[model samples]
Target: MSINTNQFPADGNISGLPDVTELEKLANELFSLLPNEMPKANFSPDLADHPRLEKSLNLVHDRLPSLFSKGEGFNLNNPQTSLPDPHFPVNKTPQSGFGVSPPAVRPGNELSLNRPVSPNSITTNTDYPGLDHKQPSVAGSGISPSAAHQGNAVNLEDPQTSFPDPNVGSSVGLGHVPHSVAGSGISPSVIQNGPGYAEAFPFSPDTPFEPDFNKLWSSINTFKSTPQIPEIPGTGGAQYYFLQGAGFKGNDPFGINQNPTSQLSGKTFSHIQNGAGHAPFDVNLIKKDFPILQERVNGRPLIWLDNAATTQKPKSVIDRITYFYEHENSNIHRAAHELAARATDAYESARSKVQVFLNAGSVNEIIFVRGATEAINLVAKTWGEQNLNAGDEIIVSNLEHHANIVPWQQLAAKKGLKLRVIPVDDDGQILLDEYAKLLNPKTKLVSFTQVSNALGTVTPAKQIVEMAHQAGAKVLVDGAQSVSHLRSDVRALNCDWFVFSGHKVFGPTGIGVLYGKEDLLNETQPWQGGGNMIQDVTFEHTKFHDAPNRFEAGTGNIADAVGLGAAIDYVNKIGIDVIHQYEHYLLVYATNLMKDIPGLRLIGTAPDKASVLSFVFEGYKTEEVGAALNNEGIAVRSGHHCAQPILRRFGVETTVRPSLAFYNTCSDVDILVETLYRLRGAHR
Candidate 1:
């Protein structure tokens, strides 16, 4: 079908459309009417002319010159006949709402509309499209109104004269206001309300604005001032002051303040006071202090060979307990009454005495408990529970008492940790090499007895402690036996913890002590809780006190602690070195005499041993030997002695144990050996 070139069907259906040739012809006719190049016009409105009408004329002339100058027949090629030159001034006339005219433009100088005007120049009226003199521009001109009225022509090319871009259309320029306005000698208020004003600027005729440059400059200068550095006064820094300062002289940072040398005054005891330095140890004189030693057992003089089980209380300890009950008996630290004061003084004085006795750095490191058993349990529950992880190992020597072994065994089982044992030699002494081999990174703790209760083997405690420390393990030395027979100096030993029972140390029963490093005690949590341990308490939360008080949760064994203090005083009066030397002599004497008995085997004959003589008789049971000794008024332990592992280590279920203290004599040792010989003869 043939399609028409210029007409479509009346129904508006496109069954017939114009051909491609016809479309090309129509495009050519539209292109021929457009100008070869659009002319560029600069319509700078005269500020003194009818400002509102002039602005409107300028907008129309710039955007649509054809409509605006249709009657004039505007031409692009002619300069004088074309749009007015931007450099030439229009005739100035007093027109309503036009306010004033800008300074006259220089002849033959032109501005290009395509190039941006410098922001510092007196802003032209055409800079804002809708603006008129009737409503002032919110972004004021950089030139003051007075300057403009006085005809001062701005140099657009000079950087100092260039204002911020007027196209920014704000009184406050985008980032920072240009400093040119400040140097222009024009008031800020004039710039805020003058011809350059626009709605985008913060200031207007209704709101006159000004800035406080003095305050701003002062703040900037202050910020740039140099800061002073502080100077320390000593060669070793702050630590030197802490150690040797006037306030810290003679004070130990770890907590102990007592001078060990000052503790050995001549006023400790009357008979021994003068002779304490060079006095010969008289077992007879020492026996006078213990009244129980004079008592008869089964019609014979009581020969206390069971010192390992518990020591007899001295007269001083008994008198101290009586004194507390009669004169100072009261619950301590909770009342303001006189008795409470006395009791509190007595209790704390005892703590101080213990601190001195152990040569601990601080009294705060001492914690009173039921005995060594509870002390070890406290560590297991508090420090052990917190520090042990699954698959970690805790090392214990074969010489540990049941008190030390059981608590850790339960802890290991609950924590899923391994309990490694350090085997002892045939002589019942812990093998130092074997102990060193057992220690590794996985070993968390090494808890050993200072002296074996069953075997009397005095282990190399200081060496063992040092080696464990080198392996990154904490050491807990059970001093239940050693504390009584030997002088204990925790500072010298350097073990993390040391525990001893007061009853075994010639003090009252139901009282003991746990000595720990100040830092370790502070780090360990309290195992028990009650009245005094808490600083503040609520149903939801509680704040506990520091160490010593934290671990001593409730009312302590008051009178017994005072008695233990008296016991320590008694030991100090006699001299620890003297007691240790005397006990060593007794041990040597007993060992030599016991070696001669036939049909008798002495177990635990370590080269370095305490005063214990553990033995077995052929053809006689351990109980029979113990019964024979008791019948003759001799007392000795006749079982595993709560140290089953060491007993079993020596291939025996039990042994007849006759142990000694400082008060035990050579006469007592002769009687014990003579009885053993009698039993051996009967067995034969």
Candidate 2:
């Protein structure tokens, strides 16, 4: 039959059999690539017999006879013609045997990328490794089908798995995916790293904040692989730089960093009448409050310089302890009466104040102990027992006090672990390069003092913490000397633990604080066992409470704790920052003044030091120097100073140490230097 011009879709007028013949020829060429047989064999190699092809061919044939009779020519192969079944997959007319089309995949339900899927299979949400949820949905507009496929196939909780972004969601896992596509998500903008998002579990949307033991362990392992790097001393004469604009009014311009003066509860500076409350502390008023400072020794006024051992408490600290005992004495946890309630409140309040003083994140992190010695023992027994093993080593400096050195030795002996010593230089400062060489996978802990009590050398604690972290070791700072000398912020230092003595800060004796990171503390077992520390106790077994309380076994020293809190309050009122600056000036001044004295040889000449002067006269024995100073009422310590290794390194049995507090005047230094000069003259 001949086809005429009028029978066509709107775009064109299909006129004749020539157009149909041309279309049929192209279709035949394409079909020939398939197998000879239909559906059962290969009418369409890519798909089975599609339903639309058969139906569309039937409709076209049925209309052909009528259309031809009307002379609206039957052009079956017109490309522009609207066939009855647009869904058909076949390209040729009904003349061909095949006519059906497979159903097109639904738009929203497309099998993305190269992923093959069964038509009857149910769709499920996809998984991505270490990728956050709330990502832009793969089905969302503009997300490619290929990205959806890869996101769909991603495996969660698999250490071997890696996802780039997963935000675009359509990635096929046949090969390594691009970092861009892998990281894509639905609401991808929401998946960012910062303080706000850091609070949530970094990778998981389903179980945010659930501890990822695998990642945690991986981080730990990574830390172990890297050796500790010794911190390079920055290009500055001083370890710390004080900004000039940080309220540099000419207060204490002659400031030698001295110990802070005692602050009376009700007193203010007399000179600044309008700014009466602005005075930090009163030196003259505080002198009367310290009873031992006034006591006579060898017919001369007592000049107490035994700060390294412990300081003489001011009347304020004593009065606070007495008031607590006389007025509100009771057991903290067990009491139900009014006195008990008041006592508990006071004790807990003291703990809160201690938390603030140390700048610790929480009160639960601060454990009340007998002193710094006990605190170190607690960490050794509790954390060391659980975490350290036979191959593990703990690094302690050669300049350690016996309290810091002995407990770790005991722990290492008990556990069959190795003990490593970080050697110090001739000037009593730790040799950082040597310390770095000692850190390795087996180095499980670092316990060091911030200041050398014997030599008055200040150690670089911040640098130590950073190096220990790199070596996969936890660091504990013994701040017995520093806590009272400087303003400390634990977060700024980023150490795992910090310990200090209450007595060193003019607080009551038998009290100290141990600050541990919450996670580390939670993991450690309590070293002691008693009533308040247990959650549930039985003859068979017991589960201890979490953190500081768990470490504290029996009833704690309540009155001393309160007194310590009061002592911290006193330091705050005096401003430790101001005190620190004054002490630095004093330390430099004293160092320079004492260096010029005849026949005097100073020990422990570290560039960085606190306000401690240790020296000996060439013509006199250590005892003779001590006696000479004592005769003039100048109190000082002359011995190994509980640091035998350091003194032995210098080939000295003892050194006369005059440790200064804030109350000591420049005249006092003159008296000691002048008296020494006189003593040398007498000997000559």
Task: Name the top TM-score candidate.
Answer: 2
Candidate 1's TM-score: 0.60
Q: Which ranges in model 2 have alpha carbons more than 4 Å from their true place? A: 1-277, 280-282
Per residue, candidate 2 scores C-alpha lDDT tens digits across 469-580 of 8999999999998887877788888989899999999888999999998888988988878878999978899988888789888889988998887787666655676555
RMSD in Å for all candidates: 43.6, 31.9
**344 Cα displacement, candidate 1 (Å):** 0.5
Q: What is the per-residue lDDT of model 1 for residues 340-403, given as tens digits with 9 covering 90 to 100?
A: 7767877887888899999999999999998999999999999999999998999999888899
Give all candidates' CA lDDT scores. 0.64, 0.61
